[model samples]
Structures are given as structure tokens and as C-alpha cells.
Target: MNKNNTNSDSSVKTVKRNKTRESLPPKKYQVLEQDWSINQDGVNIYGRLYLPQNLPGKKKAVILSHGLAGNYRDVTKYAQYLAGQGYVAYAFDYPGGAKNGCSTGVGQLNMSIFTEEQNLKTVLNAVRNRSDVDRYQVSLLGESQGGAVSAMLASKYPKEVKSLILLYPAFSITDYAQVAFKSINRVPDTLNLFGFTVGKNYFAKLFNYDLLKSATKYNGPVLIMHGTDDIIVPETYSEKANKKFKHSKLYIFKHAGHDFKGKYVTRANRLITDFLKKN
Candidate 1:
């Protein structure tokens, strides 16, 4: 019986082991910062580009816009984080977008949301021309007032923008104008609001502009993050925006204010990475 069992075991067909597949190591990325001067309609737009070094082939790109009275510095960390994740990240100072920034001043009278939109367009065009950028995978990320501009731009150029990320977007500019002016026909040429001198052109340009309607034009995926405790821009604005977007996700961080810091910023960064990867 032992001999018979041995014969049966020897007769059993031997299966060859599949070739051991070796997993490739994660790509090592080194963030290389480059200063860029983009010309938009003859206006000089200054920006910083965070390029992921050692990565081969064209990479996805993200353009980060700062909030009102903010410069590229406001979004520098975001740009660096995205670059570390194998993306080409750019953060630009809008022409006249901030009171004190690297870019040329547009003056308080000339500074408005419309002007900022133009600046964004210039940056977008410049980024698309880059040989290392995958134009088809370009994304826009904006904070506060910049968020409003990004939404408008995405809607205007839906085909160019693959995704949108808005951080506590201030969609209440028109509302604020209404409250300040009371009567549409009685707006002053220049007025001080929230410590910034705004011109009538700001109100005139946005008087009939419907943010919700414009946002719906872009059907691409959108990630809107707003803090429940935000006071500058109410969380409700983000909720309303989520409903307007065709493919949208909203995250409300408890106890987080309009500006994220510490753990809140870290959480936001992780969410951004996940969202970009999944989309």
C-alpha cells in the first residue's frame, strides 16, 4: 500500500510556479520651483510653477488661484503638495489681484472679479502651452474670491478644465453688493467694504451674473470643501454649489474656519489627493 501511494504521488502532474512578479517602487519626486512670467493681453502675470522632477512623460497639471487680497504665497503649500504627487502645479499672482504681490498692480479702481478672470485665463493658456503638461488633464483650484473666478472660468471653458476644486468660495459678492448699495441705481464709483476699496465696475460686472447658473455649465467633477464654522463665506454657498455641479462632492469640516490650518489643512490635502487620483 505504501508503494502504491508513492507511485500515485509521483504520477501527480507537477505545476510550474508562475513567474514572480516584482512590484515597481514608487516614483521618487523632487519638487522644482520655477518662476514664470506670463503675458496676458499685454499684462504681465507673475507665477511660480512646482514641477515634479524625475517623472517621465507629460504630467497632469493644476492651477492654484489665491483669494481676495492674496498672492501666490497663499497657495504655495497646495502647489508643492500636488507637485509631490507627480503633478505639475502652478500658483500665480493675479495682475492687481492683491494689494501687495509680485505681479503688476491693476490699482483698486481696475481690480475686479472680471480682471481676475482674465488673469486666470492667461495663466491657463500659458500652462497649456507647456511641453511637460498634459493639456487634457488640467485642473483649476481656487480659494475664496478666486474660487468664484475659477468657477466662472471652468464654466466658460468646460472642455479645457478637467476638474474643479473650490475652497470656501465666496459666492456672495453680488449679495454683498446688494446689501451695500441697497438700490442698484445708487452705487458709488468707489466704496470701502471689508477694508478693501472696491470700484463700481465690480458691482456692475456682477450685477446680473448668476454664479449658480454659470457653475452648471461645467459638467466635470468638482470637489467643494467648506468649513461649517466659516464666517466669511457661509457653508451654505458650498451646499448650493454642490447641487449646481453635475458631478460634485461636498465636505464640511467640523470646527474648521474659512482658512484651514494644522490638521485641517492636512485633511484637506489628503482629500485633494484622493479626489484627484479617483477622478
Candidate 2:
């Protein structure tokens, strides 16, 4: 990205590549360059390590996963805030979402729900094994579909992820597809003519993800944020997800839409701050 129109590169890696814009509020934090790569499975993943000046101790990290079509900078604001609070926040762009600096390809996993899971695992592994900080204290924050995958990862590997902050995450892929179909042309019923039974295109993958089942299995604390007027992801879905969580809390933004901003953003940030501090 052109320096005039983008955020600066502050990762821990020695190599230079696509750089995500630093989050808003501009915390006095520097990004420890990153080592980017696409795994053998063709999942695109990259990590940006952030280090706080004069940190109290070896800083813990927050692995941030972006939304569909969004990049690592998508959550720069949150990452920056975490950094200000003395956490080494790492944000990586995942395959099937936005390709910041990782390999790319077309495959069943990339096109289906499987890509999200694969990318999440790859990113988490990358963060945990990094040389700069403590990985055991690592946590996750995901938006939209990323939220769903993160939830599944936390449930499947409770020993790895301590907690989760899901922002309007898609718990039901089928629900997302159904809402998507309303705006765009609906997929033809015969599209899955071949013995396959899933909806055509994205809908086909939605059937593969079962977030409710995953959440039920996750025994960690979950903070679910959703806008009451989120047309893309109805708030009701979050309501249902909240019930599935044994140790979870929900924050509804009245009159707020998909990506809640203004007050919603402020409160959500505070919530994360509290969760990380207490836990």
C-alpha cells in the first residue's frame, strides 16, 4: 500500500510487504515485523506483532481475525487499544477472507466453511510459537464469520484459547446464506444437482458449519456483541447463541447495525478490556 494512503508497517519480521493501517486512537505502540506465509493446504495467513513500550512484563497477546473481505487493519483499533493496555496484539489476515500477505488458491476448503477453521488454526499456531512473547496467555477476537471459526477453535481446543469475543459472528452459516440470497439472486435449487445437497455457492458451505454445537462445547467465557438492527446478521441469532453459552455474556447495541460504531464500539472495547484484565 502507498504510504500516503495507508497505515505504517510495524511488524516484527525483517521482510517488507502489504501493511495494514494502524488502528484508530493511534496508541504509542510499534508493530514488531511479521513472517508471512500460506500453508501447504493453501490457507493464506500473516501475523503482525505489536509491542508496547516499557511493558510491565512479557506482554501477552491477542490474536485478531478479520471479517470477510477485510484485512488485518480491520481491527487495528481494537489491537491498538489492547496494545495501549500493555498487550502484544497480533492481527492476521486469513485465507478466504482477505489476502494480506499469504498464499492463495481455489479449493473446496477455501470456498467452503472448512477454510475458516483451517485459517484460524494456522494463525493461532503461528502466534503461539512466535519467539517474541508469551503464547500461553493468548486469546482471540473475531468478527463475522471469523467469530464462528474462533468459537469452534476455542471449543475444540479449550486448552489453547482462554476466552472469545465474537462480534456479530455467523453462528449459522445457513442463516447467513438465506439473508444473503435476499439481496442477490437466489441460488437455483438444481445447482446441487450432482448428488450433493447443499445450497449453491456460499450457501453450500454454510451447511457445513454448526456454530451452536461448537459453542455448547466451549466452556470458556464468551462476550457476544451484536446490533439489534443488524440486517446482515439478525440480533436474534446472538440471543440464541448467548443461551447456548454456559459462561457467556451478550451486549446488544440498540438501533446499531452490522458493524456497530460510536457508543457500541466504545462499550465493546471496554468489555474486552475488562475481560482480559479479570481473566
Candidate 3:
């Protein structure tokens, strides 16, 4: 595996990794961090790559995607944890994914689920092409809006994506958009959504895309996690998704809201690790 922070590809620039100390991986399976960035359609999508430095042989990979108005940091903890478990974990910030994202070009006004889907696709291609990664074993771990994107991609690339993991997916986006705007003609140039200002394009392809229906196309193993107390996206959505997938399991965390916190975080982490290990 390429351990040094250098690459010959002009499109792939390797930058300094973070040094903040926390939980370290096992001595025999130390983890190495790298700052990775790729340009897609003039937009610079930035992300961090976590590799098990000492682990031998090709490793399975997991791409972690964040939710709406959220950046790569939202999934960084999961990435780090997964990396410690001998899997290659990548966490990236989608262009226009957040008000303040590491990626450049495209603002929130031009961002939409479709655009984010394209960004995730780009990340998937980049990660799969890595020399040390097992392309056939690549999995996707998406949170909220990202989960919806992962589902769509997994459906499209069923053979490539080995497994799927959704964390409180925003499968209700289409319903919420239709009810809020009534019609596309009523969509304003910009509007406040869940405390974030976004453009009408935010709902551009939602009306046509059937997330749950499309998600059912992927025949790989699927793991869906949701909070029992989640109001933003009720646990019922996940329950329905669990039923839609050909092979899937749904776990509900009691008292956990849209974002898992406190003891729920530990439970979620453990659950995710266990799921990935099994699949």
C-alpha cells in the first residue's frame, strides 16, 4: 500500500494529515490519515482518507456521506472509528453541501439532492480507484440526505457497492418539499429550510426520484439505523426502508433524535462496526 503522502496523479493532491490525539488504533494495525481532494465539473470536492497503515493486503473501503447543510466533519468520527477496524474510511464534504464547506465552487443556492448524488458518485469513483482499496468490497455509509444518495447509487451500481448503511436517512425529502412549496412554480429563488437557506434547486429532482422504490433495486446487504424519537425523519421511514430492501436490518435507538448523541453515539458506533464486520 502507498504509505507516503505523495501521489503522481495531478488530479489527486496529498496534503498534511491532522495530528490531534485521541483513540489510536491497535499497534499492529495503526491508521494513517491523508487529506484528499478531487475536482469534478470545476468544483473541488475535499475529503479525508483513513487507511490502516499496518494492515496487510487489499482492504475493504467505506465512503461516509453527510446530511444536508452538513459537512465532512459530521461523519469524521465514524470514519476514524471504521479506520481503526481495518477498513478504509473516507469522509468528504460535498460541493455546496454546506454553508461553509471545505469544497469550493457551487453555493447552497445551486445545491440539490441530485448535485449531491453526483458528488457522492465522484467520490465513489475516486475511492474505488485507489490502489490499496478493494473496489468490489466498497460500501457506502450515508447520513440523512447522504443516505438517500447512497441508496440511489447503490441501486444504480448494485454490483459495485457491496453493502449499504443509512443513518436516519431523509427519505421524506420529497414529501416535505411538495407540501412546503405545493408546486415548482411556487418555489422561490431562495427559502429557509431547517434553519438553512437554500434555493429551489434543492427540490429540483426530488419530485421525480423515488428514493425508497429505487433503494429496493440494490440487492446487497443493507443496514438502516434510526432514532425512535426522531421527529425530523420518523423511525417509520427506516422501518419502511428496511422492508423495501431485498436484504436489510433496521435498528432503532431509543431517545435518540435526528442526530445520535450521548450513549446513543456509542451504541450507534458499536452497531455500525458490527454491521460492517459482518457484511
TM-score of each: 0.87, 0.74, 0.87
Instruction: For each candidate in the order shown, give its overall lDDT on alpha carbons.
Output: 0.79, 0.66, 0.80
Question: Which pairs of residues collide in candidate 1?
Answer: none
> Candidate 3: where are CA atoms >4 Å away?
1-28
| TM-score of candidate 1 relative to the true fold | 0.87
Model 1 is weakest, by summed lDDT over 10 consecutive residues, at 5-14
Residue 134 displacement (Å), model 1? 0.5
Higher-scoring candidate on lDDT, 1 or 2: 1
* lDDT of predicted model 2: 0.66
Cα displacement (angstroms), candidate 3, residue 62, comes to 0.5
Across 1-279, the per-residue lDDT of candidate 3 in tens digits comes to 432322221121111222453233333356799999988789889989988877888889999999988888888878887887889999988888764689977787899878887888888898889888999889999999889889988988888898999899988888787777777888888988888888888877666667667755677888888887788998777776776677787777666789776566566677777778788
Better by lDDT, candidate 3 or 2 = 3
Off by over 4 Å in 2: 1-44, 99-109, 176-201
Give the 10-residue window scoring lowest on summed lDDT in candidate 2: 9-18
- Per-residue CA lDDT of model 2 for 1-279, tens digit only, reads 433322122111111221453233444555444445546564455656566767555557788877655667778778778887778787776654563434365332234445667677777777778675677778889887678778878888887887788888877665555565643256654333122333344455444445566554676777788877787678777777776666677777667777756556666787788878776
Compose the digit string of candidate 1's lDDT tens values, residues 97-136.
6757778746666788888888898889889889999989
